[model samples]
Target: MSTPILEFATDANNPCMHCGVCCTHFRISFYWAEADDAPSGWVPASLTEPLNPWLRCMKGTNGKTRRCIALTGTVGQAVRCAIYSQRPSPCREFPVYLEDGRPNPKCNELRAQVGLPPLPELPIAPANDPDGTPTEPPTEPPAAA
Candidate 1:
């Protein structure tokens, strides 16, 4: 299903506080071709060592429990994507607030840490049935805005 774009307030009043928690916890998967297309800054420690060419997941180290290799920054510092411009397709398409209308745990955690209320749910498709067929089509959120 196509992901919805969550509109964020972009004025100076809505500046990112830079807690750096999201980049530390999420797992970002990248396609092999996308990894190859990464820019110079996106090079991780794993890429420097000899390894199999067909590998998929490159686990993060040092404070970041298990995250994508491309994420960089120490805890309490400004977290940033090494390849912000040339990020992988998944990174480019990440939901700003929700993933398939479900509240992303990482995002929710960050919001709660900052004392913000939970965001409203978005439209999303239901999970598949036992036989592997989709249970239902996407539905719109309630009109109470």
Candidate 2:
């Protein structure tokens, strides 16, 4: 039985600190417009390659190991996204914590790679879970519109 982290306090520090598994493991592709409409010094053209003419994606993600070009520092110790503020929607939307039911397998797998323990279940009341399974929540704060 894993210990549930429950809801994160507003003042709570990010649980993802020192964990960069998702940044290095995922493909991180997104629509071309994300780059097209972004302000200067945001998602730079140099860090991305065309996924297709209609899509753009992070570089360094094409190789077997699949590390994002934006990743800096060491995994499981200290790390950060170089373009976190201007990251593509997919990267921005990735889940970092488990919620009401079951845990995210990919998130778990990545956690294991970095030697972190598996996330606990949602910790919600049984009635809240129609199927009694836990879900997950987004990793970061939503970007302002």
Candidate 3:
């Protein structure tokens, strides 16, 4: 069973901890070799659909909603990736922010599409964000404006 991550610790250090707009905003496709049966990270084949012989995409992401098949819980509140440790390379590489603490343009664009505000270019949950992104997906949307 997929245990929802349930809740995240929100604080002054992280602004994006509660938002999950990007997981439903893009096509999460990756090389077929990235599947569980391969040499490394284990995205399950059953939760994916072939995009091409060389590429497979997370099931929900290839559809109209674009939500990843492994994503759990609500989008603007708490959410988790059911197969987080085994997620494919594309997910592992999608940055919420740039290396210098600027918000990723694509991330902000996706958030805007969902009525979530743009992640700030500076001071966006910087603690433990080695690559300018949160280690976990955002856990809550910004408080109502």
Candidate 4:
């Protein structure tokens, strides 16, 4: 199942400072079909490089620097994707949150590496729901004197 993505949209709940850490933290590879040259593709064909027969990755990200060509702006201050709308699945599918609306742990790790802060975890869901698991451990009832 596909995860919901903001795709250059600023989130009020998990506001990103445009830290750009994630852009430089990992390789961004996606299926070749996502490139503009392919049928129904959107990612800019010129911005990608072939990884294999079936895979492609954004330029700059494949090299040692790991920064994406599409990213522009000062990391941790202001930044944006050059091809937000036409970005590949790896970009669009990157998650700041989980299916139940909680922050993704991995996203925070990249941010921390750059001296940025972690996204705050959301309030617990209703205990009855599978997503309702509390972040904090349950407290013991007051012991009777």
Candidate 5:
């Protein structure tokens, strides 16, 4: 089965911060159609090397240690994605799991490489019914001793 689609929520308690692991550690390739949809001068044609006539991937990821051309600032210091709003679908879909949820191993590996701890499991959201009602009523915790 395919992985579940994860939602990105910025929380004060969240651990992610300019880690740049995903941007520098993986080959982010996608269909040629994606490049065409990118705004003029956003994802420059020259910066993308063709994986095939129908596919193209961003350059600068040929080696394991190479960083993406769009990455700016230091890897673990204060990095940022130059094209965050216009990043490819792959970038948008990179999971940042919650404290009780399943792990994204690749993401955790990158974190480990940078001397950061693995992300805590994501908390499972409460289930909803077909009509969007909560499957069970909310309950308060038992009284503390």
Candidate 6:
């Protein structure tokens, strides 16, 4: 399913701080095509397990947390996908939003967990970021109840 671009303003302060929460919190599903290519240099050198063509589940090593093997970087630092450019199609399109041009509620949950205020409602679009990540809708600031 192709995600339509929602028109919304970019939050200047909403830069992805690379908290790695997105990677650690979710099980990144990979496509068959992504597994065909050789692992990137950034992939952990110690991991010799062959990529499972039908791999579906992803969990952190040593019971740390659930995350994609391509996710790299230190906690609270710069975290990013090692093979971002060549990431699987599913990985390239995450946080699926509604077709009505509304932001996915799940995204708000993520921002809250990451210490970010709710984002303003915005349209979704094909993220053209250099990282090749998908563009998410701008969430509204949490209501001041």
lDDT of each: 0.42, 0.63, 0.65, 0.65, 0.58, 0.45
Q: What's the CA error at residue 82 for candidate 6, in Å?
A: 2.6
- The Cα RMSD of model 6 versus the native structure comes to 8.5
What ranges in model 1 sit over 4 Å off?
Answer: 1-17, 37-55, 58-64, 67-77, 98-106, 110-145
Q: Give the alpha carbon lDDT tens digit for every residue of 1-145 in model 5.
A: 0112443343123333446777777888777767745454345566677887877777887666678888887775456666666566677677655223546777778777877666544435323233443222123211211
The digit string of per-residue lDDT tens for model 1 on 1-145 reads 0122543333111112233344455555555544543453343435322224743343552334654455565533334556555554555564544435455555556655545444444334234233443222223221221
What digit string (tens of lDDT, one per residue) describes model 6 on residues 1-145?
Answer: 1122443354222223334455666655543334434454322323323346554333353234666566776533455566555555554465434454445576557656756555454433333343435555545423322
TM-score of 6: 0.50
RMSD of each: 9.2, 8.1, 6.6, 8.9, 7.9, 8.5
The whole-model C-alpha lDDT of candidate 5 against the native structure comes to 0.58
Highest TM-score model number: 4
Candidate 1, poorest ten consecutive residues by summed lDDT: 10-19
lDDT of 5 at 53: 80
Ranked by lDDT, the better of candidates 2 and 3 is 3
Listed per model in order, the count of residue pairs whose N, CA or C atoms clash below 3 Å is 0, 8, 6, 0, 9, 10
Stretches off by above 4 angstroms in model 2 are 1-12, 36-42, 98-103, 121-145
lDDT of 2 by residue, 1-145 (tens): 0122444443123445546778787787777777745553256777888889788788988778888898888876566677766787777566654444456677778878878666544545355567666544334432211
Worst 10 residues of 2 by lDDT: 136-145
Question: Regarding TM-score, does 3 or 4 come out ahead?
Answer: 4
Ranking by TM-score: 4, 3, 2, 5, 6, 1
How do these models rank on lDDT, best leading?
A: 4, 3, 2, 5, 6, 1
